[model samples]
Target: MKTHALGRGAPQVTEFCLGTMTFGTQTDTADAHRQISMALEAGINFIDTAEAYPVNPISAETAGDTEAIIGEWNAANPGRRGEYVLATKVAGEGLGAIRDGAPISRATILEAVEASLRRLQTDHIDLYQLHWPNRGSYHFRQNWSFDPSGQSRADTMAHMEEVLVTIDELVTAGKIGHFGLSNESAWGTAQWLRMAEDKGLPRVVSIQNEYSLLARLFDTDLAELCVNEEVGLMAFSPLAAGLLTGKYQGGAVPDGSRMAINGNLGGRVSPRVWDAVDAYAGIAQAHGLDLTQMSLAWCKTRPFMGSILFGASSVTQLEHILNGLDLTLSDEVVAEIDAAHKAHPMPY
Candidate 1:
């Protein structure tokens, strides 16, 4: 496994970031612990979780269970917290279970940070992120007809200032180390950067967005913003929520899969997505490779990627995913993937 610099002054993180969204619900506590231990032993020093986790069927009851699971691991294995880079997010608007769908504000951010610290059992979070913009984001398959013209600029700016003030307070209080963003647009990210610079607030160190063979929406503006702004991209779902793994090929939806629980994968289910998967799967087989490894390894080689964020419900799945760290894609494989992208783009 290789390591990459987080920010100009931040610590170096492993190329692959272990995502723990399924830690409590899809995966049992024992299985989650095993996966975490395996990831660490495999040289993965970055772990990403959220305050509102276990999200296959996100509910109010199991909301913070994932963080608690990680907290338990950290507590059991004392003196190991400083060895790994911990990243988690504060839930944004639209999650009914959190703050009753209220938008993130100064007070809400304070409340969220305190709860996350309690759940994680950590004195400080390496990277604290806004799960989504309060002004509404085009992420989570909302770009089809998403509109933000209804949002008032005054309200949005006020919200950003309020949250930044609270974030500065948290940083001063030693509760959070750095700030980041997720599910944010280029303009929204720019606004945060501008405000942070003008007010001397904490600059965002990373942005976690959905990036994979099937989804490249971040390639245009976000990529440029990330490079020039030095905000690394913590790419989530680098396999398109298992679509690129060929597990759901030939219409065989496995039992106890993510699709079985959510059925639509946040509206990612579609016919074109299957077509794209088949094309990639054929290429992987031709190269004597597994699609999972090919997909994850390709993410590591991207210039804009800081860490590839992926999750597994079982120890076997974690091993299978971590194996990708050793498999590097050739120029021919990259060309084939690009050709396939030209043939089938944005399936979901």
Candidate 2:
């Protein structure tokens, strides 16, 4: 697999970032470790997780279990600790299990970093991200009625300053290599970047937002912001939580599948989504492609792409996606995809 330059101050990582959100729940520790080893063998050098993971049914008890599993892998593979780029996020406010649903504070920054470091069993994190803003985000299918009229610029900037100062301190202390964002808008991302530059703080290197055949919200203002500012987009859910796989074509949820586990796949299921999936699946079959491979390959073709983030509960699924990493789409294939997007813009 080929590598891409991550942002201005970030490291070069593999095109595909192995996401481990299913660890300790849908996937056992042994299966997760095997997947990690397989991903490394296939040239993937990026692994992304969060403290509030294993989220098909996120609970207080299961929280941080994913990172613990990775920490075990790190403990066992001491020599290969630096082989890949390690990334994790500090869960923002409103998560009841962490910090009593409080916003990320100066103190919580240190607290979360220490816990993540302990769970990951690594001396440093290559990328540390704010999972979401304290001001609330329009992501996670919230765009339908997302409103920002209640936001106060002054308060938002104040929080950003506080976090930026803390992150700068962390960077200086070598606890984290870089800072990134998730579930953020273009304006929100620009605010962080601008504040970092004007205040001489650490730069925002990446934005791990949802981008896939079903979710192209990042293609508009976010794309321009990313390309101009040199912030690479670590696209999560490149398959739209398995919607792009065409497995749920006719409301037939396979046993033990994501939909079977969560029932709604985070509200990704709908008649229009199925229609969009059918269109894309037909296009893939027409081009002699598996929808999974086609979806992953198309993500790599985006101009503002940093790395495509995907999760797999089994090594079989990981291998299936890895099989498509090197597959390139033709001009016609891309054109049809764009046409489909225009027809079914936001199914969810």
Please give, for residues 1-348, the per-residue lDDT of candidate 2 as tens digits: 888778987899999999999999999999999999999999999999998887777778888999999999999998998899999998867466766677887888899999999999998999999988898888888888899999999999999999999999999999999999999999999999999999999999999999999989999999999999999999999999888988888768888889898888888887688889999999999999999999999998899999999999888898888787889999999999999999998999
What candidate 1 gets wrong by more than 4 Å, as runs, is none
Q: Give the TM-score of candidate 2.
A: 0.98
lDDT, candidates in the order shown: 0.88, 0.91
Highest-scoring model, lDDT: 2
lDDT (10s digit) by residue, model 1, range 1-348: 778787545569988899999999999999998888899999999999998898888888899999999999999889989889999988868677877777888877888888988989888998899997888888888899999889999998998888888888888998888888899999999999999999998888889999999999998999998888888899999988878878787777888888888787778888788888898999999999999999988886677788889999788898888776789899999999999999998888
- TM for every model, in the order presented, reads 0.98, 0.98
State residue 294's C-alpha deviation in candidate 1, in Å: 0.3
Whole-model lDDT, candidate 2? 0.91
